[model samples]
Target: MNIIDKALNIFAPGIAAKREQARTEVVRQQAVRKVTNSLIGGVGSNGRGYGKHGASTTKSSMLFWKTPVGDADTDIHQNVPKLRERARDLHMGSDIVAAAHKGLRTNIVGTGLRLNPAFDASYLGLTKEHAETLRSSIQREWALWADTTKCDAAGLNDFYELQGLAFISTLMSGDVFALMPSKPRPWSVYDLKVNLIEADRCATPPDKVNIDRERIQSGVEVDADGMVVAYHFSNRHPGAGGYSLSGSNEWVRVNKYGKRTGRVNVLHLFEAERPGQRRGIPVIAPIIESLKQLSQYTNAELAAAVITSMYTVFITTPADDEGGTPFDGVGMDDEDLDGAEDVPGATGDEIKLGQGAIMRTDPGEDVKFADPTRPNPNYEAFVRAMLKQIAAALELPYEILTKQFTSSYSASRGALLEAWKMYRMRRAWLSKTFCQPIYEEWFVEAVSKGRIDAPGIFDDPAIFAAYTKAEWHGPSQGLLDPTKEVQAAVMRMDNNLSTGTRETAEINGGSWEDNVQQRAYEQTRLKKLGLVQAAPTVVTPSEPSNEGDEDNDDEEGGEQN
Candidate 1:
């Protein structure tokens, strides 16, 4: 005991000093943590903010949902299929969703996104005349390829119709894929064709190859840098009707681009918002819940109105007296009950009504007409409010989305202007993601086949870009008030803020060149017919006519005599 006690006594002073220092360090860390947490934002208990009710644990409004951080690919991979199915179901059922998709198709891809070849003349070292000639040649050839069934893989829809279908399909299924496979048909000169498939077909293969440098997210295979390298597709739709699941198992892996040509092979079309989002969320995702509720509310109101209109009366009989209804003057008959159809609701009873019939219950019996205070007074208001929110989420105005322009001209015009802004943005996106890429791939083949005059395109990337410089023209934004809108367009042109080419193209979806040429032809024809059009004469009220009026002179002479 004495020997051990000596060692403990010797190290006691050092041990005490170390313990105090450790305690002081712990206190310092706690103090620093408190300062940093306060400076940044103290622990937010349930919501967006650390202040006020956001951190209140006991408040009913504070749900205290604890969500851990997750990547977009992980999230999208789990929910996209269900979301796609729900979105498709809603599109078929919900009037609002159907209308949105309808308007989207019309606005974004009306007629079609026609290719307007705008050759970069400056970059190509060509004069305006030369560039325009080349553009015309390429456009004519493009029309030959895009306007026929030859452009489609299935030999059905033309490129123009495919635009609308593809756009709607993307919005429906969150994403869509297009495989540009070449097939030489005896009827067609161009071998390029477009084939579209739903997003379901594009999915991760069963045996996942997760290497250090490459991995597959859902169906998209990406490199270490997150650049899409390839896409995996199933031969048949994953949801095709099959008793055995084996039919949906086989997958085809397609590279994103042809290795030799560096031309686009598979086009994966989607609208990814987040940085790491491997797939798209459906366009109707944000409004899904609201739209579903609104659809149900609308249906409920409609049914209630119909039932209210259908005349039904409840006849209660006394226990002592079981007799005929007063009006019919006949006892409740088996045939009448059997013949009567069930009421159009969950009443599980037979009821009928005549055009101008009166019901008189027996003295002992009581009668109560079914009075469902329906056609709810707040139905329109509630629907409109919900639609406004839905429209906001869809980046459209309530008036534009619903096509109810009961508002003033200014308000209607303002809504159209705002809506057109979104439409234009969407049109641009479609042009880039869907239309332009297809055009480029088609153009590549056209160049190789000597159908298009794109010299030096194969040699230089910059040259290819210059030759492929183009503009996509969709349907015009219809004018609400033609007079005012036309005048505005005129003013814009006069001020040099816009050009005649642009004004004609935007306002009427017509080419300025074509309009001018047609007008000139008409004028020349009029001259030949000796019916030359004259300039309209204008006279000021202050100025007198060149010839004096004979009636005025005669009246003056008579008055003088």
Candidate 2:
């Protein structure tokens, strides 16, 4: 026998045994963690809650705040239509519009399912070819539920027609998402399969079970106080029985068919319009109506998923970089530095917080001392208010209990604003710092080419593109845009239009005459629109009010009687 063959035979059992032992250890650890952390009984962060009779401080464990039955208090829910109108006025598309135009986006939600170890061996017992077929079946089932598309109005209408089939498919898909149950371990991954529903698959039941019903219009029944009601009706007991209205103001109606049978529920929101109500006005109507339909099955309940809107406004101030300073290394005479001893040296904070600073120097002074140490506390307060409003609307208080979740979400928001600010500031800084060098190089070339007299350097897109696209000699080429200057200029024009005047000449190209004409046209238009200093034409009253008139008083008394 060969030496190698003998060695392999001798050590094979030892290696296999070690591998099996390691696998067993992993399984044990997982079991321990899941058991301990579970809400029932154990230890660590898990053992609290109903089964264990111990409550957890974690946000995930807290019962969601009950949303008020009817309209949200404090006008917290967004006026979606108005917001969209405003966006349109700003020449920007709304999210719904964008979604309708583009396709829906898919993303990873929670963790994916894990294999059940108890059934692992049996699952593996199937032939390899059969196992492949089973895996394909799972994939097909997931695709039916996980995939979504945002089509135009016509397509959405088609989906509504197929609502029943969609609903059944959604529930069946959720059952496919089973994962191995963990008792206790270091890490536990939670996965969720979300089901979507159409907005209008409901009908009112035969009897009113303490739920107030109001006839808002002919053939249209709504709850009292003008709330639109939609319900899923099931003949079974859990879905139809044991459901009762909590109070007059309560809007949630749970239709229980029977114990452990099914749950049929309806979420109510104020109707968009009714008789004695103005048409096309969004009167506290539910915006995300589809979410209500999703709650028909499972333990899911409704909560106002509040979203606060905000804009990252930039406040420009003077630059504070040492390189940009007059006497840093710009060849300022030594006497200037000596004379400026009264001024404070710029710190890192000042340099970074360079925007929105007040120039504390003299009006005639060239070297502006922008106090970079202080940031706009007002802006910070505005951001905090926006966050608080979002939380409050969601019926949640900003507390330490949900610190981890709050911090993570809040950090994301702050990070987005910070990134937006940094991007704009960086662009501005680059423009300010690099302009002269770029201009100088172009100017030199233009002069040499007999094209400098009319300042053609800024106007010639071809020349700018050439310089931008040029690269060091190598086998491969750089991917820089050759038309950088032209593109940047166009972007600046777009930015100006978004935040300022629509007069293109003021921001882009204009002669003195053109500027004058543009200003005159704008002023005339504003005056015509009653936005300028122009008095609105007074008209005679359509009808005079009968104040303290006996005739009007008699008519009112007759109607009352």
Candidate 3:
């Protein structure tokens, strides 16, 4: 067999076995670490730290370290176990890291991170003008701030903190920059550094003007007007299983006669508007009524049912009319219906076209009401219940309860009062969850790459992909396996050699001998750098050649005459 095949056969199995063992051990070790961390207030698997509730299963949900209390801290040691659990309970995994990595790579390198040199070169080769053009519009507000304020480094730091609020604004929109390999990092190389260049400005403002400016800036003006109201509910019909929560507790816009107002922009009303569709798991309400009913189901069964019931609520809920056309047609479209084919027509030309009837439909009944002055409170309550159910399923705190934002509810200022508040809170929590670990590594990488002076932006994916490919897997050894019965020729040679038969071992056919030489060649290539020795020579029997064949044969037959 060729050198490649021989080498693969020799090493593949061991690598595979090692990888599998590592994976299994990681999980097993993580389980053990939880017990350790709970007892000792430390993380076990990666030695990073215990996550919330003392589980090292989730990286995103990892708990930040607190300075240990008392003097026993000296004995506590940090460890990095070779085998780390591959996944965590409700924790970030390889997929998440890969995705985050992909995004960052693309942003930094001007292309996706595909691990290809050609891709990287193509992206990096972009003209200066083109690269600059792709960057998002530089916000002028920061420039104004730097120019207006004559602050020292300390004051500048405070200003930066305030400006970070803008980053939160970006995060809540679900498109903020994030990094991977986050822990042990203080800043991300992938993150673009936001520079506040001081601009030439006039004299300082008076005291009265400064106070007014502070009040204006501090007002709720910066909150998002746009909101996404997501309703999470269970598949259950009612009772404890029927809980719902508002998923989109963020700002949504307000529209007055088609004119928009408020700091936030849009309104998204997402609901599981279907029957029997489960969107989230149900929660066991500690209330006596809920607990009594929940006693019938086990935790596993209840969790499943809760999930199903939430889907039901989401699917069954009616569409939010935030962007809906006003359907005012019941009496107004009488003329059109009169002339329509379904109804015996009186006059086609006199028919008016608009909305249809507004009667509520039930099984074998249509309930008609004279008044349509206000929204059905019962329906609103149903929506609230759906959101509450989601919170229950997720085991969220009461403070994180469900809320709704409606253009009508905001008195035309904006519909997202509660949503805006929730978004701010969620952003803060999520930021803490996202930022700390990433910053450290990012800064080092950036400094090394000479990108410290570069503007703040995500790495381009294309270049990042190329770099990763060259750096990570390029040098990594491929999986290999070694077995005695790897090739047909090897097996045959082994048989001939072991039998001590003259068939191949004879001067004319040394197949086994040739295989040994091939194997040696492959061994050198497969070995780690500077680890392999020179390939040993394996001598093979030379092929026979006919020389004076006829004369010799004739002489032997003639009996030496």
Candidate 4:
């Protein structure tokens, strides 16, 4: 080193170190630039602004934790058991949680989703009368299969009731499974029986080794293409059933589709929220933490209120001839006190607080009243707020979730309508994933057995879909104002916007054709009784329509508590 540089380093070591660090940084940048320039494609646009938004690594402490980019199933596989457990726990323990699931079940598949058979006559090249005949035949056969004695494998519930159970289970348990294992009944012609398997039973066996290249996750066996090929269903529920079958574990690996027939054997019913998500997330997963917190808060508040409501009396005892505390600061047992009633909440002390309750203390003791400032003034508001959050997470309106419709007519109706949207969506999903497949399978069996006449169904997928293509109508959204709703329905019908058949289903969940035939029979019987009257005049669209009274309380009135 130069004499002057050596002297400066000894005198100003910090300045010399700073100079060397700057030179090293310059060299590092040059190396980075050279490597970057060699690549055919440049680095992501402006480094994709990775230091902020979505996944961040900025100065903010909140952005410090980095999330992995693993596939959906990989992330959810380990967490499934806990998620399902908590969901079921909530359903069993919390009334609000149970009500959420119940509301879904009621609104989505009340009674059951009724099959409205719509046979495609155009492609099938069948006459309208022929189509109608086919529909009637199918409906008759469907009724026989839907019987409680024949439809369910256990014969516990009819097909309609099964629908509600399965859908509710799906919400509470993340998913549900149906095994279409047929066993013929002595009297029933249909051998198709639906056996619902709990989500817990359908999972990879405990002793399973990676023998095959296929990945088995949460009971679902997926191929290299990420397509679910089969499900491993244990004979016993893994969550409850003992994991043993005569000393060895057993699991039935049911294929998604039959080997030769291509019919789906195991129906894995779940709503996939992400691509490659092999299983469903419980409906309340997003709100689990909030639910737990709110539940705890509610419990704490209730306990506090209860404790505060309790009235305890402390009397000062007279000491011989001086003033002092009573009972020697010891609690007296109920057996020692005559005419003493046991307190509801008090332990080791007498705290009975009945109306006009008279307490006889020791002589010279004076009574001191205990104040119970309880029943929080803000309790209702806080509970309502929490319920609103939970309702939003559940995709239900607050009024619908709580069944507290003490609002204006518009508000009540709006809440109902909003809840119906979610209900309808869930119903459609259930019908598509659960009901339709089962029906199709049942129909296929019926066709093969010569119970129903069909041509080219097995050969043509289109014809098969058309024949099986049906609409499921669950419970109708009941009217808030019957007269107003009826008038609106009539108006739409007069304008050719809706049909009587559709209106019948929407109004009271009935088949218009069935209603018409029933009406006709009733009219005939009435005429035979000689009680017939002149037909009511039909109101045409050109006729003047009556406007609703503005003074009526229809707009603001709502259901009473």
Per-candidate TM equals 0.82, 0.19, 0.17, 0.83
* Tens-digit per-residue lDDT, 1-561, candidate 1: 365446655778676566668879999999997787677666553223654465655566766655567778666777898899899999999989999989988988888987878778898898878877887788789889998888999989999999998999988988888899998889898998899988988877666645332378778888777788899887778667772234446788899988997888888888888887888878999778878888898898897786566566777766544554434435544544543445446253334553334544557778887877777888887787888889999999888788876555555667788988988998999899889999888888888888777678878889989988888888789886665567778778777998887778788788787798899998999999999698845422233332223334444222211
Model 3 Cα lDDT, one tens digit per residue, 1-561: 466546656878676556668879999998997877667656544445444345655445554644454321111111101001111111132232233223222222221111111123344564556433322111122222222222112234322342343232222221122212112213221322322211000011222234533122201111133222221112221122333222322222222112341111211111122332111111111222332232323343544544333221111222346443333333444544443232135354432321341222222323332333233335445434543554444333222332221212112112223333433343334333322212223333453556432222235444444332221011111111112112323445666753322223221223333466687777776684556566655534334433223345444332222
lDDT of 2 at 81: 34
Model 3 lDDT, full chain set: 0.30
Every candidate's CA RMSD: 11.0, 36.5, 40.6, 5.3
Give me the displacement of residue 373 in model 2, in angstroms: 25
Predicted candidate 2 versus true structure: per-residue lDDT over 1-561, tens digit per residue: 466546655878676566668879999999988865563454325534442333433445554533444332113222433432332322222232222112100000011111111112132354566544544443343233223221112223221222222222221211011111112222211122112332221223434532443432211244555543333432232223454423222232333222362222221212223243311222112322321222221112111111001111223433556233322323434443342222146642331121232223322235433233223345445434443443333223323112222233333334334333433342233222222222233334334444323223345655433322211110111112223323444556566733222222223322333466687898899888889565645432234333333334443322211
| TM-score-sorted candidate list, best first | 4, 1, 2, 3
What do the candidate models score in CA lDDT, each in turn? 0.78, 0.31, 0.30, 0.78
State the weakest 10-residue window (summed lDDT) of model 3. Answer: 76-85
